[model samples]
Target chain A: MPMLRIEGLDHRWTGARQDTIRVGALALGAGENLFLHGPSGCGKSTLISAIAGVIDVAEGAVCVAGRDIGSLGSGARDRFRADHIGLVFQMFNLVPWLTGIENVILPCTFSRRRRRRAGNPEAVARRLLGDLGLDPDELGRKTAGDLSVGQQQRVAVARALIGTPDLILADEPTSALDADAKTAFLDVLMRDCKAANTALLFVSHDRGLEGHFDRSVDFRDLDRGGTR
Target chain B: MIGFSLRSLWNRRFVAGLTVFAIALSAALIVGVEKLRDGARDSFVNSASGIDLVVAPRGNPVQILMAAVFGIGGTGTAMSWESFEWLENMPGVAWAVPIQMGDNHRGYPVIGTDVTYFEHVRHSGGQPLQLASGTLFIEGQADGAVLGAEVAARFGHAPGTVIVNAHGSGDVSFHMHDDAPFTVTGVLAPSGTAIDRMVIVSLAGFDAIHAPHGTPDADPLDAAGLAVPPRNTRADHETHEEHREHTGHDHDEGSRAAAGTGEHAHPRGRDPDGHAHAPERLNAVYVGLADRTGVLGLQRAVNDRAAEPLSAVLPAVALTELWGITGTAERALQIMAWTVALASIIGMVVMLSATLESRRREFAILRSVGASPAHVVRLILTEAAVLTGAGLFLGIGIFILAARVAGPVLASRFGVQLDTRGFDARELAVLASLFGAGLAAALVPAIKVYRATLADGLSVRI
Candidate 1:
């Protein structure tokens, strides 16, 4: 069975009359890296948020590890997401008050399953950061707000790979980096995801990142043939 | 969780400082107001010490005490001299010192009493009156007087110095008793009593100056009063002395004697034919009881005297009753204080709520990092409590400084010393109540933070 299965997911904001999402089906096996390309206003961020269990779907079910996520309560969905899914946003959304290592190890605090799978959560964060060429001192010394753009992007990748979550959702995570930094970030992020046996769903507006992934889905074709 | 919350607050120190300052200022005002109430009450209570029973002609006891103890009213009637003697001779009578007002010497009241007043009266803290300078008057020396500390100090006078009385309350007087000038034989210690600015003289001095100028033997038939004792003989009596330099004027003995002696003195002491004297009556007397246990009994005895109408009062009870009549004013003050406190709490609430608008992003970021909505709520509440607690400490510190600085001055002026160490349970309860109210104010904003964070859900809202 695939690690994630989505079928006929649909949504609209509670107050809005128009549907924002209408997707037929999608599936990702363990250890697969899929690149999703779309421009602004194509609901790329919205889809990622929905898959992370942060937003409720208006129709159909999203299954993770063969369990239907649609029937779970809000708190249960949050717990499920925290346990099996690690999400990284385009802006490297780390709490500004927490140090780099502390931000990387956060999923383990909310999910015991992730914590157990990582063997030792703090060590896993440190090793991943070290592999990504982040300074060891930078792990403990710098808060997320204090780090540069490249450093922040690398930290976000490290965070998503920690705890060995079955799925890693990266939403335009390398968009802020220069080409050299982007290439370096992709190398470590893809390599770490493969080693952890986690499926990567990478979303970005940039087409150049497509070849690095095993599969590519253009979001424009998935949404009413919308194009950017 | 605490670490994160603290770090977040640290990053927003400007906002935190403003919130903390507001809390501190409100706390200071609330505590300061309460302290002032206690201080004023303490001063009042202290002034009432050692005064047991106060006897006055039948009327309001509150009025009598307000006038006598507080220097706050017009003269009531005086008890008859016979009645005064009767009370003083009673078994429980310690000393009955009369307070004669209605006369002023340069705005200071002239109190006519015996020397026993200075010897026996005890003030707050069991302190006795100590003479500042000179000596108390001899028992029968009607012309000798004691100056209140300020009066003597003001005029640069000691024993053997004389000051003329102006014969009335205000500085304006149609008549002056220049011939019967008061010689300062003593000066009283600073008692913070009505006596502090008084001119204390023997009771006999008041009688002598006020003695009516008429012969006791005068009959109705001797209508015109036997030719006015010869205009030439009065001329000689006036012309016998050389002129002495006086304060704003130069005057001789004739003007002095004419000004001092009023025509009614002779009629009060004698008939027109010039026989011996007769005793006139007094209106009231102040009686001090030796055993306060017997005040009621002594009052009853004094009231039973069939010879005259009178009333004896316990000064403390009378004062309490007097103050009770002005309960409206006291309530008004309390309401004002309460309004000020309420406004302060509302200010804190508004300030905290307003700042929450800017902090929504911080809360959203926190939510993204696995902090529950409840955690955000706790963080806000803790920040408020910290501000209020710091402010409370600052306010109390200011109060202590005030007490230390102002307490003694008030004590010496009012005969009542505040005990600075006397912070009772009531004060502590009031402080705790303010803190609780402040925490409640903070909770309102924290709840808003919780709701906004929940709505955003792992995404930055602002």
Candidate 2:
């Protein structure tokens, strides 16, 4: 079975007249990377929100590790996501009050399975951060809010890849940086995902960087629901 | 979880600190109210305790307590000496002692009673008045007086020192008993009772001075700021002149104590030689019964059977009713304190609820990372509990600290001892209720976080 699979999936915002995101079938195998591309307000983030179980799913099947997430309750879905998936939010979803290393190790505070798989989660976080060309010793002490935008994005990538989950979801993780910093952030993110051999779903409004992924799927191509 | 909660609080510790303070004040108000109420009752319950009934001319019983026991007001219609004897011979009466009053030495009431007062009178739960200096006055000792601790301290009359008296309650008195003098033979310890503000004398000496041709006047209250007494007779005369000059009261050829004669007498010659002469008039009589059961019957018996009109007041009943009459004010204060606690609770809830809007993205991130909805709620509730618990502890600390600081003043003013001790069961219950209130208030915010939709995963809306 593939690491991630979606079949006839549909989602709608509360009180909306029609499904806002619809996908007939989408699949990614181990080590496969799919660049999910669309412009702003194209429902790219909504699709990833469902795939990550950040929102409850009811219409159709959304599966990770061959278990349909729609079958699990909200709480179980959260556990499954934390165990099997790494999420890298675009705006650097690090707790601002914590240090860089503390944010990197936060997932271990929640999922014991991930902590066990990481084999010393702190060492794993440090290794991932160092592999991404960060000065772990220095950046580890700086609060997440104090880091530069590019540095913060790399730390987010390190946080996502710490546990070597089977899947990684990076949602425009470089959008906040300049052109030079964006390429640099992509380089670190791709390298970390390839090193972990995890399937990648990279959501973005930018389509110019499609060559780096194994495949690219546009939002309009996947979601047949009407959207401007 | 604790680390997360603490770090989160450290993020906005100023707001958290203010909230903690509000809660602490509320808790202190509640617990302090309970303490003061108990303290007041304890003080009243022990005030002038030992005697079962007070027999005085019929009037307000509470007023009798104020005047006689608390040394607060003027002595109401004096109980006659005949009535004192009549009360003594009653069927249920174990003992009765007549107390005469009308004079003051430096604002402390001068109490004239026999030596049996020392043997039978009890204070603060049957605790006898232990002497801190010298000896109690012997029955036959002429003009020898026992000073209560405060009176001695205020008037500077140690053993062997003679103190003169004024003719009325010290506040309005214009006369001094320069013709009648009291020799301080003993000083009682600070009993934290009304006796601390009185000078005790033998009944015989009291009558000897107040007998006919004993109308001399001097102001003892003038002695508050007077210089120390001179050792020689000449300096005594000088201080006496100073007293007369300041008070505008006459100091006649004062009571002469002829050293070799073994007899002291008013130089006014009211009594050529001071001798034991019981008076025909008395102010009040305190009675102790043989048993508790006959108290009401004895009260009725004394009221109905006395030849002269007299009333037997159950001291405990009068005092409790007095407290009840004033109890509404206590209840109002208590209610005001609880309102403060309620405000603290609501303030805490409002503060926590405000944080929910700012914490939505954080909550979303937490949920995305595998925290259960229960975990989300727990985080918020745990934070509330920590703050409220700390506030309660701070309240208790302030309560004890304030009491310790105000203990002496409270002792002097109200005779209410500051209860400095460990948390009693009621205090513990108050603490528990505070925590419960915190949880209840936190639940409003907790459920808000739990039911929250994670729409802005990486975006900070607030």
Candidate 3:
């Protein structure tokens, strides 16, 4: 079974501007790495939200591990997301007041499945931080707000990679990093996803980073027949 | 989650601390105002305890209570001493203490009563009066006086200090009784009642001062024939000069005449020529019933007396009635205090709402980490509970500190003793409602954050 599958999904933004997002078909197998490239405001974030169960589309089926999440209630959808998916935003991903390890282990605080799978969540969080190229000992007591931009991004990556979620969603996460730091961050992120057999749906406007993934698709190609 | 909430608040400790302080101040104000209101009524009620009835000239019952027990205003008429004697010997009457007023030592009222007044009177929950220093004045000791704690402290009077009486109750009186100065022989302990502000002397001394000069043979009990002595006389000048020499200062006199002739000058209401006299009239009388059930009957009999038009009132009932008249004002004050409390809670809501704009990104970050909208609501409610709980505790501390500092001042200045026995049920109820109101008010911001979390998801606008 694929980690995520979407079929004939359609979403209409409510309010003054009535734009629609339509996805005819999409699938990512377990452990696959797919890069989603698009221009800004091309509905890439909307698709990410749909895959993560943060939003239910107005039409169609969003299935994770063969279960259609769009059919679930709002609360159930939230639990499903907590248990099976990890998200990384562009910047300021960590709660600034929480320490680095605390932020990394936060997913387990809400999801019992994640907590049980992590097996000693604190140790797993420290190892994940160490694996992501940040010293766990140094960051253990330091708040995320005190870290450098590169360091904060690494902590965020550690947070996403914890508990070995079925899929990792990266939403232009490296947009704030320098070129060298961006490449370095992508290398570790891809390595961790591959090792965990977690599918990766990396969305960004930048096209240079598509070389690191197994496959790449433009967001415009996915929404071909949408009524703009 | 609560830990998380606390850390978030600590991150903004400066603003959170100010919010808590504002809540604490309102809490203190609310509890303090309640204490004052209750304290005032309790003091009034306790001042008349143990005495069943206050018998005075016919007039308003509350006025009679104020005049007789609280020493407030005059009774407007004086009851004959014979009436007091008659009440003293009435059936079921345990004891009756005659009270005479119309003179003051400086601004403090001088109460003219016998030693029975000290023995029968009880206050502050049936506690008997105790002298802080010297003994109670002798029954017929014309020159002897016992000062209340406040009066003694105000005038610095102690054993053997002689004080002259003034004819009226005003703070300043020019009609000084220089020819009939009374020496302080004792000082009473602080009672937190009107008694604390009185200078008590025997009726013999009170009568001698008002008696007409050289009319030794006049009927002593005749209220209509008693005359005021001329203000200026050779004896007055001689006594004033001796008083000046003895006292050193015109305003206050110390104990220079510790063994002066004032002690033995006219033993028990007599002139040097050897005449006998007694008090002619009385302002009021405090009566105790032998049996509690007979109080109403005795009160009726006193009021229905055929010889004189007099009124008798139950002290407690009269005091409560007086308090009822002022209850509206007290309730207004209480409502104002609670309004201040409500304003503080609203202030907390406004503060939380103001920070919601800045914390939108934070909420979005939590949502991305799998915190549900329900979690967001709980987080906000927990923050409100924590702030109000902390504020409640700090407010209690502030109230206790204020009560400790203000208790004695209120007792001495206004004769109101604060019940500083810690948080009572009513106060706890106030605090509980305050906390409940705080959380309820916080729901406003909580729901706002919940909706924003659902709408913004992982993509916060800012």
Best by TM-score: 3
Sort all candidates by TM-score, best to worst. Answer: 3, 2, 1
RMSD of 2: 7.8
DockQ of each: 0.26, 0.53, 0.74
What are the chain B TM-scores of all models? 0.72, 0.77, 0.84
* Model 2 pairs in collision: B175-B218, B176-B217, B176-B218
Q: For residues A1-228, write the lDDT of model 1, one tens digit per residue.
A: 888888877767668667677667788999998898877777787788678776776434688777677777667777777788877777837767678998888777767788888888888888888999998577688888899988888887777777888888888888788998988889888888898889989989999988888999988666653322
Interface RMSD of 1: 2.7
Reference-based lDDT, residue B339, model 1: 68
Best-to-worst ranking by lDDT = 3, 2, 1
Model 1 has a clash total of 23
Q: Which stretches of candidate 2 lie over 4 Å from their true place?
A: B101-110, B140-184, B192-199, B204-277, B451-462
Candidate 1, B102-166: lDDT as tens digits: 55677666766666667655655457777888888876466789987767776787889987775
Residue B70 lDDT in candidate 3: 80
Residue pairs that clash (backbone atoms under 3 angstroms), model 3 = none
Residue A209, candidate 1: Cα error in Å is 2.2
Each model's TM-score? Answer: 0.70, 0.84, 0.87
Model 1, runs deviating above 4 Å: A1-10, A22-34, A51-53, A56-87, A92-147, A154-168, A191-201, A214-228, B1-6, B57-59, B72-74, B90-97, B100-311, B322-327, B402-422
Cα lDDT of model 2 by residue, B230-314, tens digit: 2223543443334323221223334421110111222212221222323445778889898878999988987885477777889
